[model samples]
Target chain A: MQPAVPLVARVVDLVKNYYLEEVVVRALRGITIDFAVGDFVALMGPSGSGKSTLLNLLGCLDRPSSGQYFLGDQDVSTMDDDELSDIRSRYIGFIFQSYNLLAQYTVVENIEVPLLYQGCRLDERTRERCLSLAEMVGLGDRLDHRPMQLSGGQQQRVAIARALVNDPHVILADEPTGNLDSRTSDEIMQLLTQLNRAGKTIIMVTHENDIAAWARRIVRMRDGHVESDVRNDRSTDRPAPAAHAAGLTASANSLWGGDPYRQPLGNDRP
Target chain B: MIPYLCLLLGFGLLWLVVPLAFSDKGRRSFVLALRSLWLHKLRSFLSVLGIIIGTGAVIILMGFGEGSMQDALEDIKRQGATNIMIRSVKASDESSTARQQRIAVYGLTWADYERMQTIPTVVRMVPMRILPLKVHHLERSVKGRVVATTADYAVVNKVQLAAGRFLSDEDDRYMANVAVLGAHVADRLFPFENALGKTVRLDKYFYLVVGVLADRMATSAVGGSSQTAEDFNDDVYIPMQTCRGRFGEKVVSRQSGSWNAEQVELSQVTLTITDMESVRPAGDVVKDLLERYHGTKADWAITIPLDRLEAAEREKERFVGLLFWIGFISLFVGGIGIMNIMLATVTERTREIGIRRALGAKRRDITMQFLIEAVVQTSLGGMVGLLVGMGVVFAGPWVSEHIFDMHRPAVLNVASIFYSVGVALLVGVAFGLYPAWRASRLDPIEALRHE
Candidate 1:
């Protein structure tokens, strides 16, 4: 018997809608996606394609209007606000496109926010952890600097560190570089790739092609459903694929069959 | 004692619950509250200005109100808290006003004095015969009211002999013609020499001066409608028996070309009571006894110091309560102003609220943050206002003396300061509730989407 590896997050036929008094706008018709424990998946689509809605549901920022959503089999779609807050604080980290660091707080303080919500006092240990996270994001000397004092790249770096502060299993990034220049955008993408290479599961929402190209697999949404899913093995640098993902050695490689990113290897399915 | 324990227990409960509201998330909110308040200094001060004026006005007004009430009681108190006065009022039935111009005798007699002595609550009796007489010493003649009573008069009236001795009871028994001059009377009668052994003539009789009274603040005639008026400084005190023997009861008066004569046996009788509680009842008994003897209505009136003291206290309590509500209304209005500004603040910081929510702050944390900010504003206002109110109280009497030329006494009541500050805190929390609650209920997703 093989030991089970818990999935980071899984969703089955998720649907969401917005009501306008007399009109019901279907934001998400039906969507099914799963993120493995160490998968790096980018959700890509055009505007009005419900990619943001999917990211929101995945981030635990909102409940699915209808669907079975499991955060490691906990079925978070049925959870209430407080439970969602706990899950968001404990199980997942979020990075916004706008780099929403609290302006009044210093860089280190901003990074400590999620830890605080997790009921961690800002004692000596917490301070040390915050310093290391800031250093990890290459802001070791800017710990005491406010968000307004730093440049766009520095602020996003602070957000990245904030998202990873609690050691959450999965990170949800919503257009992490939407407000940055192309050069700064490439730097943020490199940081995300480095994190994913270290075995962190990263789920990102983006409309940019090059940004999506950094991910090992891409899921594209259109009109609230997955229009296509593809695996890009040649676009960027990542640690060579894992044995379980490459399917070159084991007869048990059929585990990749149900993967939305399995299209490129369908010739080996029989 | 039981009530005190209950109060202590209630305080302990408050101490416990207030801190629990500030859990792990609460400290961050507090820091946020402080930062946000500092971000807008002018608006915070302006918002709290109303509370300052309202609270300061209430505290200062209440202090003066209480001081004046105490002032009135002390005025009555100096007359003697345990003493009751019975005075003779001229009857209205006198077309027989000395019909024939013979001296008319009507009022408290020796029999009234004798009946007062028989009452059980009467601790001591001081009888007096007052006559307006002109006294001549050396080269000056001053007209003054002279009172004739015994040694116990000094004890009953709270008077101190400045020099020499008051008239002893022995002097009353043997009809010695020794006298005590009052402060004003002494200043007039013997301005050149000490009046201690001088002989002052009243008509054809001469009395040796034995004592002079200390200069004391003049007790203005009480205006309570039920009390009679008296001025004691311009009087000379003599032995009662000597007054009857020499001046007699009939006094002839010739003022401004009017010559008429009136006769009074005992002008007034003051009785001291041993127990304060028995005054009103003892007064009732004295009234019944006097009315039975006089056979007339309103012929005599009684004045009980204890009764007036209680009435003054009751009036002061009611006045303080009225002032309290006036203060509360202004603070209440100030609280409304706080709510209005806080609501605006909530709307303005909607994006900040969203960002905090996205950072994983709970509804409880958001509520505490805004509530603490409101608390900070009002409490700062409250403390500064307390100091300002005290400053006003300190300047009160001086301002009165320089501007209105009327004396206004004010006291700094510590209780009032505490009450004002406590009310400010209470009103801050109460008024901050709805805004905080509203801020907390904003949807996280929608809030983040807020432009």
Candidate 2:
């Protein structure tokens, strides 16, 4: 990995307010954070805790009511919708929890959308790049299939391919593994881990601790405030038994991370 | 599938031409719009329904109207666009003294024809004397109108000769006992054998048939002219001198057991002007000359085809205006339909818009996508309308002749097709503006949160 990477995104005292009729709802309240290149960070918060709000602002999907957002050298806090779109297309890619793939397009088409918006010619070279990205996401054989035809996990992989196709500066994932079962989620997490290992800057939003633990660094939020930011040294804390299971691999955590698995999050629900 | 593909190709060309900073990116917006419409096939089709009908109706109705107008104009035009006719009225509505005269004569004379020729704009003048005379051809006898005129009569009246030849200058100069039989006259007098070269008896004289006329639609007397609406088919045409020599100026009529001789010289005088600009001047000159000669008799009336042509054009313009309004209303309704559908579509696809916005689509991109969808629908509708309109135009004449028995030919004007399609597209884009603006105004966050 490259050393002393530059900051990919930085937010200073960000605030976002929502107007519902005559009432006002404050989604994000004076939050400050910074992310560096090659950093795989997970954002953890409950519903209405403003993690989604911060993700939206970082994705350039919305402007903060106050304070500044800088994606690299560009100040995005005061930009208009068109300028924001330019920033997003240039520097950001998003992976949604529901896998927001357009129904009319096939897996290849969905993956090509961001590139298309970047004014990239969908020539033979562009098509090859798109196919290669699909292959990386393990969707090489499903290029012709539509989102509806694929299972939930496969749909998520297609979304992953889409996000990576543009080769953006950073990937913003809102609940990357929220809708998947344990086995599929592990597979997806492994793919993400490989991408991160390849030095991708991933800022993922998830309420699950186990998913958050997959990240090298974790940022926990509560009521629009950062509760804690810490590094998780899972290799030193966990047992090393069955690290090599000779050719048998049932899950991503087992095959990729050399571990069985743990249900360390969602136990606090209800 | 082809229509959808055609929509894409058309949009692709447009995308390249639009003033966007990034044209290829703009094309992606069109792709998204095309896919969205594909999602709701029925709705998109319904939205364009009004436009199709509007275009079809405008083309079809305009076709029939223009065709019939031209047909009437042609009919009047066949009378010669620059020709003006002056006919004798006979002064029939007068008191007892003139009616009881031995030879009541109130009409154009040979002297008037001579004077009419001297008018500045009068290029040619033809005068004719006609009377219903008993004609005999062997065993067949028919009462046919005998017209005595110069050779210029056939050219001025659009008379076509079937066989043999028309009256030459020599025939008129010599007062030759030769006649040209009209279509119906020949058909009646000599049904099987050819009428040309057949000797026909006119009044008390036997005349050789020099020519036979082809069948033609007889014209009606126009604009208060005293000329009667007579079918020239059952008439015998002879040289000017021949009738004057054989039958003289007096024809003895035996009606209701009473016999009387009415001396009539010239029945009608047709004058051709130099050009269209000379028609009114020529008509005025002829009227002035006749009024000076006949005094207070009111014995002549005039018909100018150029004046009729202008009147017909005015009437057609009014009819076209009416059609235009009706067509415009239909297109307006179609526009409204598109507006309503686009508004609903914007609302329905709010989440998708949010997703696209998040994926880096600018407000202008969103606006263009929606606008292009509306245009595609309308253009497709316009094409369908043009197709249907053409089909109706071709089939209209047949249906009119067979079922309605009204011989109206629907003529398609090339410009109308372009105009209708262009207007339909314009209306669609106009109506689409509101919805596109609405979609573009959507806040990305709020839209994403709109379920």
In candidate 2, position B146 carries an lDDT of 87
* Model 1: pairs clashing at backbone N, Cα or C within 3 Å: none
Error of 2 at A40 (Å): 2.1
Docking quality (DockQ) for each candidate: 0.42, 0.47
Residue-by-residue lDDT tens digits, candidate 1, B1-451: 3245345545743773477465656666667777877898888878888789877997789778777877877888888888899877666764375676566667788988998898898899999888888778866888898898989999988888789988898999999988899888898988877889988887788899999998878765543647755667788898999999998888788859977677778988999987888888888989899889887645577878777788788887787678778878989988988899999998988877877777677787678788877877787788878888999888987899799898888888776776777777777788998999999999888888776
lDDT tens digits, residue span A53-99, model 1: 88888878888889978777578898887777767776678888888
True contacts kept of each: 0.46, 0.70
Using TM-score as the measure, the top candidate is 1
lDDT of 2 by residue, B1-451 (tens): 3245336555754653464334655566666667776888888788888998999998898898788778877877888998998887767654454457866677888899889888988877888888888789888898898899899988898889898888878999999999999899899999999887889997678999999998878876554333456687988889999888888888788879977666778888889888998899788888899999999988778878777777777777787678778778999999999999999989988988887787877887788878877877787788889899989999999998999999987899776686678777777678888999999999987887787
Give all candidates' CA lDDT scores. 0.80, 0.80
